[model samples]
Target: MEFIIDTVNLEDIKEAVEYMPIVGVTSNPSIVKKTSPKDFFKHMKEVREIIGKERSLHIQVISKECDEIVKEAHRILEEIDDQVYIKVPVSYEGVKAIKKLKAEGVHVTATAVYDLMQAYMALAAGADYIAPYVNRIGNLGNDPMELINELSNRIVQDGYDCKILAASFKGVQQVRDAFNYGSQAITAPVEVLKQIFANPSIEKAVNDFNSDWYDVYGEGKGICDL
Candidate 1:
């Protein structure tokens, strides 16, 4: 299961990249607004430089019109590299833009998906990725994992090429749940990824090993050299 950190802060992005072997980063308007100084393109360029040119950088288009979305997608792709994944909401216009972009061989992520029907719609509309908001659905008192599992099964059943990406993860539990349900990717916050390594036993084991090694070697450069 692939994981992408959903953040715009450079520090958080760098922290997650250092700790986790993630493939990419996912950014939205809200995330950009949170950390950036209102210059979205500049922030995105900073991210592109940090992650390098060969990384998958997912950016969302806020416009509702198909033409506008397509134009925005093109702008974002040009801002970074050709590896950008344009994320548009799951709507009629969004589907139209997705089809057009996909026909042109551009990777599209149909985001803001809330239900199983929308997931199928995204696949039918030729979207490369369908993102289901797991914590958001769970917040609405719906079983988010159920949707993740059902979509996973349906995608495999139909052998669709659409990737099921689980988004809006609350914590490590949600991340683990998405992978457990066979989600193709899990997009989560950087803090959540850092929390995954917070196990006390793992820390204790590493500290104990370091202490023993130091005691045995007496801070020597190499035991063999001694």
Candidate 2:
């Protein structure tokens, strides 16, 4: 599975890129709200530069009408590279806009999905990606993993090219679960990525190896061997 840095912090994104092997960056209204930058587009441009043109930059549109969504999508398209995937909600109007944009060859990501049916609908509407809020589903007393698995099976059965992007990850377990269910990608926060390296056994293993190596040779001698 692929990981995406779901944040607006440039420093965290850079660190994540260096260590996590992320495929993209995902941003939404809440993420932007936290940053509260004066120029959202300018920040997006900086993010694009950091991630580079080869990686996907998933961005959301704040429009309700298909025309407005299209307009926003075009604006973002011009501002960023071709890897920009414009995200829209899973509402009635959003579905319409997704269809129109998809027909026009614009890459569209249908976000805010919570159920198997919504995932199916997004694929049928020609969305390039479907973002299901897995944690949100669990909060609402549903099993997000089962929903993701069902959608994965459906996508396989229909031979659709759409990939499941598991969003709204609450912790590392949700990320693991999403991947275990065959999600192509996951959007998680920086803290969660850091937690990937926080296992006690991993820490102990690294420490023990370093101690043995230090006992064998001094720091200078180890450096010389390298």
Candidate 3:
């Protein structure tokens, strides 16, 4: 499964890439607003440099009209590298844009997906990735895992190349559930991702092992030192 970071913070991205197997970085307008970079394209280029060309970089388009969305997608490709995935909301117009972009052989990610129908539309429109808002769907009193399961089944049955990129996670459990439910990729904040190792028992186990090693080798001694 691919672990993607859903933020625009360069420092967090750098740190996460250093420690975690982060496959991609995603950014929406809200995420971009948090950093408020002076030059958006330049900042994105910096992000690309950090992640390198192998990992994907997703940048959302702000346009609402189909034509403008297509134009913006091309602009993003021109401004950023062509390998960047253009994220379009799964709206009527956005689906149209996805079709157009896909026809042009551009990488597209359909975002803001809340329902199964939205995902179906994006998949039919040939989107490379479909991002469903997990926490937001749960907050709306809908079962996000069920939706993910259904979508996953559909992808396998229909033999579609599109991947389910689960987003909008509130906790580590939600992230795990997303993967358990068959999400191919999950994009969450670094803080939430770090929660995977937050259990005290894990630290205690490590401490206990270190203590045993010290008992045998003397204080502050390790196998590598010897």
Model 3 Cα lDDT, one tens digit per residue, 1-226:
9999999899999999999999999999999999999999999999999999999999999999999999998888999889999999999999999999999999999999999999999999999999999999999999999999999999999999999999999899999999999999999999999998899999999999999999999999888889
- Give each model a TM-score: 0.90, 0.95, 0.99
RMSD of each: 2.1, 1.5, 0.6
Evaluated at residue 40, the lDDT of candidate 3 is: 95
Compute the lDDT for candidate 3.
Answer: 0.96
Please identify which of the two predictions, 1 or 3, would achieve the higher TM-score against the true structure.
Answer: 3
Best by TM-score: 3
Question: 143-166 in candidate 1: lDDT tens per residue?
Answer: 988988998898889888878889
N/CA/C clash count, model 1: 0
Evaluate all candidate structures by whole-model CA lDDT and list the values in order: 0.86, 0.88, 0.96
Estimate candidate 1's alpha-carbon lDDT, on a 0 to 1 scale.
0.86
Candidate 3 scores a C-alpha RMSD against the true structure in Å of 0.6
Candidate 1: residue 147 Cα off by (Å): 1.1
Candidate 3 lands at a TM-score of: 0.99
lDDT of 3 at 100: 94
Enumerate residue pairs that collide in model 3. Answer: none
Q: Where is model 3 more than 4 Å wrong at Cα?
A: none
